[model samples]
Target chain A: EAGVVQSPRYKIIEKKQPVAFWCNPISGHNTLYWYRQNLGQGPELLIRYENEEAVDDSQLPKDRFSAERLKGVDSTLKIQPAELGDSAVYLCASSSWDGYSGANVLTFGAGSRLTVL
Target chain B: AQTVTQSQPEMSVQEAETVTLSCTYDTSESDYYLFWYKQPPSRQMILVIRQEAYKQQNATENRFSVNFQKAAKSFSLKISDSQLGDAAMYFCALGEYGNKLVFGAGTILRVKS
Candidate 1:
């Protein structure tokens, strides 16, 4: 089975430039999440989507960062006028609850590494 | 608020030896989930193991196992017969039922041959 897929495994951009990351979640998964991981740190949740609706996005920086999951399958996270502190790995994960077991396991993608100069 | 802590920033284990990575979390919710994720040079987040809060028995997967202490709010991972492939950044994460995950800074595991 195919896992969650992300494009542009590595990206380097100058400060104040616009950048975007794409993610294609696993088929049949209803929950998609975007996380940012700094060097030597664990991932921090930026946003979470349930189908076409974003259920949790309180951590997202509305001033510059924006995300959308239009079709409920693929998602895109954008950072306008990116700053030097925006350098980190953007990870995408998907999960679904098993009706019987009630277990929700997250499957992660390779992640997009963004280096802002 | 929920927070996970990994006191050891780095640890090493000789090949074929056993090593334990310690983790502690603070959460008000009694029923939640704990996870151990491994990230190698490839930078992929791989799920190593998971422990349900209500489960009394510890979780074990192959050479990897978890010692879950509910009252102590501690979850530790034990890797037996460590191999070079096991060297990576190990992260401890906590999540409540139908909630977002809270992660620690992570611990670097180094396996010496």
Candidate 2:
């Protein structure tokens, strides 16, 4: 039983550059999520995907942030022309959609730390 | 809109002692889920414990337990016989079916010898 997997555990980029983070959810999980966490703060959801379709993405900065869950198994979060304030840890999580029965315990990845200078 | 609040920014307790972290959330939904996640230096979010809104009994896991007050919308985590390994940033979150989570500002716990 492998947990959620993320790549580039650490990333460093300059402001105005483009950066992307990747996530591979647990096998058979139907729901995926992307979250951002700033220093001293909790993780905030940027987007959510039910399978391959994005069900919620209101918190994402559409101007500079874009996300895709092509096959729903793996997802990508991108931030182009990044800003200094964008420096934070990007976390990905997944859960079964049986939330109604209280089966939505999320399993999270180690997260990708993005440092925008 | 639902919101979660963690009043304590940081807390410390000696090993083998007990400590409680406070959290409060606002939500209109009658049925929801509350969670306590621990993020250590490794940066992985680990579920410490969770409580369902409809459940009256508090949720307990190993040495971690929660005090859920539905009427007051308060959820607090109590770590019994705390260990140095318990040091981490603890986040309180609220979510309902098909809805995104609303998280608190988080409380950092420091376990001292």
Candidate 3:
């Protein structure tokens, strides 16, 4: 059983450029989340997807940031006209309920580190 | 809204010693979940341990354990026999089913050999 997989472990982009990160969640997991972690800070949720539907994305910057989970298995997060402040580690996590445990535990991937110059 | 706080920005402990990391959370939801995640230099977030809000018993995994105080809204992680491998950034998070995590600022733990 593979864990949540994210591609491009590290990315570098100039300001005003466009960048994207990809994530492939664990098999049979229905809930997926994208979070941004700045240096010395904890991860902040940017969006959440339940299958093909984005149930929560209020924290997402609508102007420049966009995300999609087309077939419900993989997800893509894009940042157009990236700014220096947008540089951070983008983390993807997935979780599901196991009947035995009443809690939903999440497994995270090796995040994509984005550096915007 | 849920918020998690970790007052310590960084901590250090000698190898083979014990260390305790403190965390406080504010949430109205009673039946939620709390977690401790470790991110090493590799940048992969790993689950260290978790405690269910409704469970009165503290959660223990090997040398890692959690002191969960539901009434006080405090969840602390105690690492016994701390090794060099335990050095990392530890984050305290709170979440519920169908919701995303609310994480603390994180504490960087340093192990001195």
The model with the greatest DockQ is 3
- Candidate 2 structure quality by residue, lDDT tens digits, B1-113: 89999999999999999999999999999999999999898769898998989889999999999999999999999999999999999999999867887789999899999
Query: lDDT by residue for model 1 over B7-28, one digit each (tens)?
Result: 9999999999999999999999
List runs of model 2 lying over 4 Å from the truth.
A98-100
List TM-scores for all candidates, in order.
Answer: 0.98, 0.97, 0.98
**Candidate 3, B-chain TM:** 0.97
For residues A1-21, write the lDDT of model 2, one tens digit per residue. Answer: 999999989999999999999
Q: Sort by DockQ, best first.
A: 3, 2, 1
lDDT of 1 at B38: 96
> Between the candidate structures 1 and 2, which one is better when assessed by DockQ?
2
Model 1 misplaced regions, further than 4 Å: none
Residues B11-112, model 3: lDDT tens digits: 999999999999999988878999999999866999999988878999999999999999899999999999999999999999976678899999999999
Better model by DockQ: candidate 1 vs candidate 3: 3
Query: Lowest summed lDDT over 10 consecutive residues: which window, candidate 3 chain B?
Result: B94-103
